[model samples]
Target: MSGERSGDRTERASDLMQLNAMALEETELSLHEDADGRGDPAAAERLHRLADSMTDTARDIADRARNLADPVPERERR
Candidate 1:
């Protein structure tokens, strides 16, 4: 990763984030502790929060990658 290009790094990070999100969604943590075999609401909520944060960070990284690829002129940048 030390020598990785910006686009490659961005794609890798995005893919990893997606993989983790899928893993979290498939995890047994959401299974209920009772004999009913129902879903656990707290676990589901925590999963969603984690997934959302990962997604948001991936988006931010992508935005940074895009900016690095085609940066605004010094005078034009906000």
Candidate 2:
């Protein structure tokens, strides 16, 4: 981490965020397919809950990664 720039970390985290968004979109499509096309409300509801949990986890991951990537004070680096 010594020589790494904050910009690089920010970009990686941003990419992760984008990927998370794509995952959510895919989940939505699947939910629609199950709920609307197949009329399986139970399965659709499960998928919906999974997507919600994933969203929270993804945000936490992105935030943590960004925070870790930032340069720490000299004393804190140890």
Candidate 3:
């Protein structure tokens, strides 16, 4: 049986990706502040790493949603 309705699934996935992207942006700003103004190199480095990981995860989530939303080709119809 199908689990989530397609529209709901797509909306939820998009929301999650957007949230992650926002988090990444916030982390980047924090990283810049910590490095350039706060004199906390260690914190900046950690935040930088977190931002990078978040970016990768967000892209993966978007890719997954895109793959799910793609229609099956007529030649491949069951």
Candidate 4:
């Protein structure tokens, strides 16, 4: 997988590896905050949306990383 430092594919994979964990951690924390019920109703709703967005973004990033790490053959790409 190529990163900003494309010379080191291992480094890129290692860096990509962190995204899901960080994203999930943030998602859980956001949901926890919502459950704690400290914020106003509007804020809670927004927080839920934020959590969903985080999850979706994480999945997208992870999918991209996977493709980079294991590139598809040109024939298979079609």
Candidate 5:
């Protein structure tokens, strides 16, 4: 039903948010490791890039979820 579909969407959004948080944590750890000289500079750079990319993706997912949860006015739809 419609309610079930909405619940599913909400769950998916929650998952995305969790993933975003995890990615951020990973990025932070990578940065810390690099700072401590325990991580490779090149690998740290790659992790930073990946983190940025994931952050952007997460933002897009959040935006989509928000839009889905609260649709725009009919005039704004098209």
Candidate 6:
């Protein structure tokens, strides 16, 4: 039962990681477009910030997934 629960959690984490990565890619494209003259400087700055936020989110999601997949030692487990 515990193993099944762990498997489910891992799957969920994997899904989240994929979703975040997609979001980061999409945001990066938007940022590039904004810098390519389709958008103003202010708008581009906003897009850049958005992209940075998405990247941070993706990183956080990946980190969480890694932690879920390979948990810390018993003494270090949170």
Candidate 2, 1-78: lDDT as tens digits: 677788876767667776775676677566555555545678767776766676676667666655655656899978
TM-score of each: 0.50, 0.48, 0.53, 0.62, 0.54, 0.65
Best by TM-score, which number? 6
Candidate 5 ranges with C-alpha deviation above 4 Å: 1-38
Model 3 alpha-carbon drift over 4 Å, by segment = 1-36, 72-78
Predicted candidate 3 versus true structure: per-residue lDDT over 5-25, tens digit per residue: 877877777677667666766
Model 1: lDDT of residue 42: 72
**Overall lDDT per candidate, in order of appearance:** 0.57, 0.66, 0.67, 0.69, 0.65, 0.74
What lDDT is obtained when candidate 5 is compared to the true structure?
A: 0.65
Candidate 4 or 1, higher TM-score: 4
Q: What is the C-alpha local distance difference test score of candidate 6?
A: 0.74
The sequence of per-residue lDDT tens digits that candidate 5 reaches over residues 1-78 is: 455777687767766766665666667666555645635778667766765675676567666656655667999989
Stretches > 4 Å off in candidate 1: 1-38
lDDT for predicted candidate 4 compared with the true structure: 0.69
lDDT of 2: 0.66
Question: What would the TM-score be for candidate 5 when compared with the true structure?
Answer: 0.54
Reference-based lDDT, residue 2, model 3: 80
**Candidate 6's residue-wise lDDT over 35-74, tens digit each?**
6664467877777777778777777777777777776789
Ranking by TM-score: 6, 4, 5, 3, 1, 2
Q: Write the per-residue lDDT of candidate 4 for residues 1-78, one digit (tens) a residue.
A: 233566376447846666774768687677857756845777777777777777777767766676667777899978
| Clash tally for model 1 | 0
